[model samples]
Target: MNREELKALGLTDEQIDKVMAAHGKVVNSTKDKADKVEGLESQLEDYKTQLADRDTQLDDLSKQVKDNADLTAEIDRLKDENKTATADLQKKLETQAFDFALDKALTGAKVKNSKAIRGLLDMDTIKLDGETLKGLDDQLNGLKESDSYLFEQETEPTKPTIVNPGNPNGGTSTGDDDPFAAKLAKYN
Candidate 1:
């Protein structure tokens, strides 16, 4: 590998010089190839490091995308539930308003047995329209003409809910409110 080692293998000076020149060509070619390989190995390591970092970034982005999708789905579900709850609450409010209005109307009509009259009145034709009940007035008038006994007489006054569920005429046939009816019941 060195000039001194070649000189020690003693031929003539010219022959030694020629042999050293040929040996230099082969050794320099091999050294150049080894240097190029080392450079390539270092470049390969750099590329590998870059690829690993990009992979990690890609994984994080993918996880974020999945989380966003889950949140969107949850938001959609809550919106649907809210819409259903709002609709149910609106329906309940409308029903209560109608019931209150119907009670007030029956009381104003002087209905003696409210529960009895309510059963006789046709409900299918009734509808609430902005604080007014459609088709209710006509139905009430028809009932007043056909079933006049269900209302308070012109001279006598009576309570609206004068009847009970068990007995449509009144709560008791024993007539607890009248002394004559009570005496008649005792005789019977």
Candidate 2:
């Protein structure tokens, strides 16, 4: 209430001064409390934002760790596959080299049906040496000798014969001494 109104209501000046001082103290106290609450609310918001950022960072780190593990597993698998493939390649090369040596040896021995010879020969025991090849050659020669019927036998061509209907022995016919033509000429 206005000081004039309070005075008109028969309030003494000392009582008015006491009431005003009490109201002023209450307003100041409320303002101070509101300011403190506002500061605390601001700090709480900052903490919440920091927590969100930390959670995002943690999620990113977790993903990176999982990806690294997956990558390491993949690398190990690839290394194993590479080792297997390399071993297979080496084995294939060795087999090809052995086959090539066998083929060359057969060719040098002038063996027909080399594939058959290869089938008959023992791959494990066959050595790539001069004596071994000579033995193989001897075996081939023995097979050729025993199986001579396998080779083509060429025969001598027969002489061609000439036949003449006019003469039994290809002699010329004597039309000049024909007795039938002489009779026909007399009739004409």
Candidate 3:
């Protein structure tokens, strides 16, 4: 309990002094070690906070990347759709223009002589030769005759009488001879 009691209990003064010094040294060393540990713990806590912040930043970056990717994909899809729509509209416009050109050509041809009309309409048909050309000419002539007939029907209140000269048999003239041949011959 007391220093004197320990001394009286058979401890020597030298021994007690040595033990006290050693214990004091151990306590001091323990205190120093504890302070170092506390500093190390604080540093570890700081490192943990930094790691947590980095994780949050990484998560935010990942979300942004995902959003960007999604937006890019959507843009690509819309671009493709727009491209298809534009192509379709262009095709329709081209078809309408072609039809308008054909209609104008036919109307102009009708106003002029059948030969000149045939020449104008048959310009595209001239590219063919041999049987193909003949067939195309026949088809073009038929189209012209039909167009003329329709135009006459729309304009004339009375139908014109058909006069047959080529046919030996009593029949209306079919007008088989290419009426446009004379007009087209000038170009040839």
TM-score of each: 0.46, 0.36, 0.30
Pick the winner on TM-score between candidates 1 and 2: 1
- Give lDDT tens digits, candidate 3, residues 1-188: 44676576566676667657857865785586567656656755665575566556555555566668776676556556656655675565454444334433444334434445545454554432321333344655676577655332334323334455775655654545547865776688
C-alpha lDDT of all candidate models, in order: 0.70, 0.60, 0.54
Error of 1 at 27 (Å): 99
What is the per-residue lDDT of model 1 for residues 49-95, given as tens digits with 9 covering 90 to 100? 75566556555555566658876676556556656655675675577
- Residue 55, model 1: lDDT of 55
Which segments of model 1 are wrong by more than 4 Å? Answer: 1-67, 156-188
| Candidate 1: clashing residue pairs, number | 0
Please give the lDDT score at residue 10 for candidate 3: 63
**Local error of candidate 3 at residue 39 (angstroms):** 85
Estimate the lDDT of model 2.
Answer: 0.60
